[model samples]
Target: MFKSSHLPLEHADKKSWASGGASSSSPMEYPTPLNFYEKPPMFDVKLEQFEQSALDRLRILAEIESCSARGRPWDETKRIVSTLCQKHLRLSSNTAGGDLGIMDTQKEDERRKDHLSHFVLRLAFCRTEDLRQRFITAESTLFRCRFEEATPAERTLLYESRDFKWVKVDDVEKKSLEANLRATLTGFKNIAEQNDAWDRDAFYKVQWSQVPQLVEHRRVFLKKGWAYVPARQQSAIVFREFEVHLRQALNMTNRAMPQMDEDTRLTPIIDHLSQGFLAGVASDWQYEEGDDTTKLRAEQVDEYAKKHWPLCMRSIHDQLKKDHHVKHYGRLYYTLFLKGMKLDINEAIAFWKKSFQGGKVTEDKFNKEYRYNIRHTYGQEGKRANYQAKTCVALLTGDAEYGCPYRFLAPESLQTRLQISYADQGLQSSDIHEILNNKKGSHFNIACTRVFEITHAKYVKKGEGLGQSETVTHPNLYAERSIEFETKKEGPTKVTSKQEDDDLEGIIMQVD
Candidate 1:
């Protein structure tokens, strides 16, 4: 709906942004900050640049979703999103100054990357209903933020540049609708005050469908299927229209994606990007000092499993408790997880020692059979691999029982587990439904992250927990984060066992 510098690749000339020497009269000036991605940008791009830009944009969209999922305040979400965009996906306007070294050519390249990346991710995310809706929410929020921050003159230019068919209400028409317009004005106590506001502001009439959110909120005057939208709330029309066009484009793109399979290079990138998004767009994670894991205790394993562990680890812990023994992979997964949580080797031996008692694996057999494997995990025996906790990516393809529950559990099973686990934390049927939907959509990491956020919503609403959730990357991350939020009242207790870190040089040495 907006005039973009973007030109569909099939129709564009061979010259790319970086390559050029032709002096064309119509320079590729994007002209405005906001875009609706009406055309795919034409450019000679290498596969590396294609993948990188797509990822950078995907990060921006993921952050927007995370902010909303964590219930961040709108103003704060805007601030955080702005900072990230400036860092990873900056789109400077034509007039943006040299203080930032934004040359005309550089500006064109930025616009090109922006356009290309949008289309690439559009292809990647268009494959499913869940993906399409997720894409819509993130993209709409991004468009709304950019529209809100644009200068008044730029905003007007944006509207003029687009063919949205918005009709300006005349003074004569305003008088006829003045009473009804005034009715929609909030924070005004008197008719005179409402009249002043109604006269001072402008209004645009658009199809009611284009601004459904405003109509639904009863913030606009609706008559005969048209919405009389006040200037201040006009961004709703922009966002809704963009969303509408994007949804249609995505479905079209989804149909066209099969043709992309012929482009062997691109197919993999698109598939990988889409798969990564479903797994929650992995972010780098590193353990740091002062994490609560240093205080982990053997006796707290059951309670912590209930409160802090990811579904995968929790399932293994439960299996070990009930049966007093786990299969080889589950034992390996859980032992390394406990190690990564900084559980002392002595406590590790003791925890399994106690867990395996009163069952087939007696204490003597646990010491002879299981303790060796636990020590091997810590580099005290065997090849000294000294394994770190498994990542969600690795675990998803690893052993069945210890892998992601979101990836493996039946809908009924997952729902029942979620219901029982979070019943005390105000888990609603809708939350359960959302988790099930994401699971069905194969957004396992996102589903896991949602479970974390929803289950902890009680404390977060009270300003007492980690305000945001990362897609579950590792069991230790889930474990540590849960310990932070769930046990706030108990506080970080005294270290029940050794808190000192093992030597990295010693641990990371070649397997012996």
Candidate 2:
């Protein structure tokens, strides 16, 4: 079993239990700890603190998830995660040149936040198998990064505290098996080549099954049923164990998921976090003056669609035009994009009502069912929440007709659409094939950007100023960049400030 030092256990015997009878006439007093370092706070935290902490942690985890999904090298992921932790969570690196003694107060608080945030995400992710697997993979990578970043002394302490037991290979046995060890163990080969160096270090013997990664990498020497892992490469062995134990724990958590639903406060928070994770962080797409896109008049949408809109949005617009209506998810998606384009509630109603009237939807039926939803989207009704544009991540993960075309569309379907859409623009079939190939290899955003580059090849070759060379992760970003490219032919075009561009590409996330 993998036990986290910071996980909280509920004790029925505690006097402060909600269902327990009071022993004194006065209200039973509960012990209030100064911080989570000493004990888990059973009471509610301040709303601001709760939200800030969750958002900060979410940013870190989201980066880890994105990096893992892209198959980034572990060293790069570790550096990015460590830097983000320092910037957002205020948790500094423990591996700055030398081993430092633990600072109890600071370290404990950091540990508490790490523990609680993980459990919170677990609740969010355990509802679905796909979500659970993603969460586990990202979390395992994060844990490995932290382990690698920790000082050797800190790692030793952590290992000892975890009580993992492995038999050590004796010096005499090591010498007797020198030839086999040299032949089978890659790490040992270097040390074996130098006399007396092999005897200087201790070797741990574990079951061959326990270190499948090393076996797969051919990094350990195997004899009979045991694998002899060098102390230096032991972290790999330990991380595999961590992954296995975590996978089992997550499966168990999923089975007990029903109990988690009772906590209404946390349930909603978890839901939002899951959505944010899928949609990209909410903060990334905040509009600033130079980078902000102009709101298009309803009449101008088709014009803008031709010159600026991304393939996904363009596809949705075309479908709406063809059928004079869209399915529920498609309608919601299209409406939000229009809303981001600054379509007023009145204009939006007129536009939708006109489109639907030509279809099976009567004007009276549209007013009855759809008008209020449009008003709601514009924040004129109900909770008055301002709906933001849908991001590529959210659309890709969503189980809806409206999603990223590069991801959701079948290859044949996508090819057909690309050919039809770009026929007049002179995009070659070879270019289309390359774009689809990139999408197949999981370069989804890159594929979208490639479409833009191909269509705007003249402007690109002429060096018309595009703000930055980033993959288009949002429809709005694509539109804005395309607009800038088109406008530069007539006169000077406004570009996003370096800081704003960096912010968009950095840790600030887009919330849908």
Candidate 3:
């Protein structure tokens, strides 16, 4: 059992947890307090350590949330959570048939990590009701799984260590309640020695409201507003308490959220982590297997836009061509897409410079303000982080032409764009209507994929097009797959620098 004195009282005060204290020089100086769920508190961590621990825990919780939202089976969800805990958090599976020795160094480390990670995530998730609820559900499920798998001795130790004061029914009371209890309790009907079993086993007398799940399922015997719950059903009551406590904690944390805004570094990190949770997992673009983009030149962007770019990228390209300018977000999104398509930095600069020619942006102005951002996307400047293209969720929630068109565009506007863009490809009004319906139903990615299939019906092979099973995630993925389909129809080809420069000149002349 962890000592309460070692536990940080900072969490109890809303302001303290949100505003972490001065940077600790060593881990031993900053020992985390012990808790019921997480035993053996961790100590001595730097700011980076704290941030990373929080991020790791967030990943597990995010995965759990995703699994729940998708209605994945309980066994599969448990399996995934268990695997993640073992791999990332170093927590061992209680059901895996071996007892972790009390003095085991690795076991102690894992326990400390598991304990600290939960508190760290609490700081990030307490800001919103939606986030709090999601975090609560995922964390509750995780704790329940661990509890269920615990060995008999561990379970007894845990139950005794907790503050629960459940009272056991007496022998005379048990005898009187035996018939009702047997009928109401799950798995107690066919006992050969009913009285013997009833006498030997312990039952807690809880308020009827405390075990509502049992009452609803008719699994507990209720009399005079009292619920007679067996040992096996105690988990329901205990987990409910866990949920209530966490909910209250989160509400308190939400009150402290405004203070977090003052810390710019922490605020962005939290926002980004929250966004990542909503975005689901990152997509594997399979860039390792070299594709047609390797041989393509920047000048071929327009040609590729017509045949290979997804609806989102295609919309951005058309807007840039027609208006001869795009907003900052549109430029960032489209430039990133182009870079993903293997357009080098110099070619990207030329493409943007040409696109802005007939607009308000002059070449000198573009260089002064826009050049660094373009280079930054390619990891050639600033942070030099090779940022991946935004995911479907990111695009869906973005503003000012930054988001996915299928999600953000008005129904009529989307319909009109699809009609005009694919008019020669036999796009019917019914097709447009169906896409609109998908968008209404929150199947935005599916709607975009449907547009792709409709535009490239002839090129899509049997059982090869975007089906109900496959969801279009990244614009880059859409572009890569579309290019792959084209490459299948036509043999491999390469673009020379002369061809790229010629295409660039044509684009510039058209703009002029």
| Model 3: ten consecutive residues of lowest lDDT | 498-507
Clashes of 3: 2
Please write out the lDDT profile of model 2 over residues 164-212, one tens digit for every residue.
Answer: 4578888789888887665543433455454444555578888899889
Give the Cα error of residue 463 in candidate 1, in Å.
Answer: 7.3
In model 3, which runs have C-alpha deviations exceeding 4 angstroms? 1-42, 93-103, 186-202, 256-268, 281-325, 345-388, 391-400, 404-512
Q: Is candidate 2 or candidate 3 better by lDDT?
A: 3
Model 1 Cα lDDT, one tens digit per residue, 130-176: 88999999998888888778878778787887788689899999888
- Please say which candidate is ahead in TM-score: 1 or 3: 1
Give one digit per residue, the lDDT tens place, for model 3 in 368-440. 7888778877778755756556666567667636577787788888888888777766678877776887677
For candidate 3, give the lDDT.
0.64
Q: How displaced is residue 139 in candidate 3, in Å?
A: 1.4
Clashes of 1: 0
lDDT of each: 0.72, 0.63, 0.64
Q: Roughly what TM-score does model 1 have, to 2 decimal places?
A: 0.70
Error of 1 at 296 (Å): 8.2
